[model samples]
Target: MIKHTPKQQELQNLQQHLLTTLHRLCPVSNGAAPPPPGEWPTTRQLAESNDITIYQARNLLLNLAGRGKVLVTPGPVNKSLRWYPSL
Candidate 1:
């Protein structure tokens, strides 16, 4: 089983909340699906939108990507990432 720290749990909660918010805020043709791959927001944008540190945002997304909750892709440059919800 996976044990998460208190802070990690908090972030996980935030990530779920973010998904709900994103689902509402993100423009999608299909009401039930996440945005297209091209429309996936950058990690920086996700952090800025949620007022969280990039480290926190990236780690959360990384965890999700690992678990197949989201689709992650490398950005055009180093130290950058893009993600779209798969949940």
Candidate 2:
């Protein structure tokens, strides 16, 4: 069996919650809204829409991407990344 630290457990819980929220906000669908016309939204946009801090938004997006719930692409400006819900 495997072991999990308290911090790890908390992180897992947060990831689950973020996944649930994302699904509720943007249900997965092939015909759903395309990511913007060109590029995806920056971390700031995701945080603003989700009402979370930038750090939280980044973590949430990364988690979602890891779980295949969202697609992440390189941003056009700066070295920041963009996020789009996977359909």
What overall lDDT goes with each candidate model? Answer: 0.72, 0.68
Error of 2 at 83 (Å): 3.6
Lowest summed lDDT across 10 adjacent residues in model 2 is found at 32-41
Please give me the total number of clashing residue pairs in predicted model 2.
0
lDDT of 2 by residue, 1-87 (tens): 789999988777766665566555545566756645245557776567656788987886787788887777754445667666677
Candidate 1: where are CA atoms >4 Å away?
1-5, 25-38, 74-79
Q: Which candidate should be chosen as best, given TM-score against the real structure?
A: 1
The residue ranges of model 2 lying beyond 4 angstroms of the native Cα positions read: 30-52, 76-82, 85-87
Residue 70, model 1: lDDT of 72
lDDT tens digits, residue span 1-87, model 1: 999999888877988865665555554565566545566777788888888888888888788778887778755334567677665
Candidate 2 lDDT for residue 10: 71
Error of 1 at 82 (Å): 0.8
RMSD of each: 3.8, 3.7
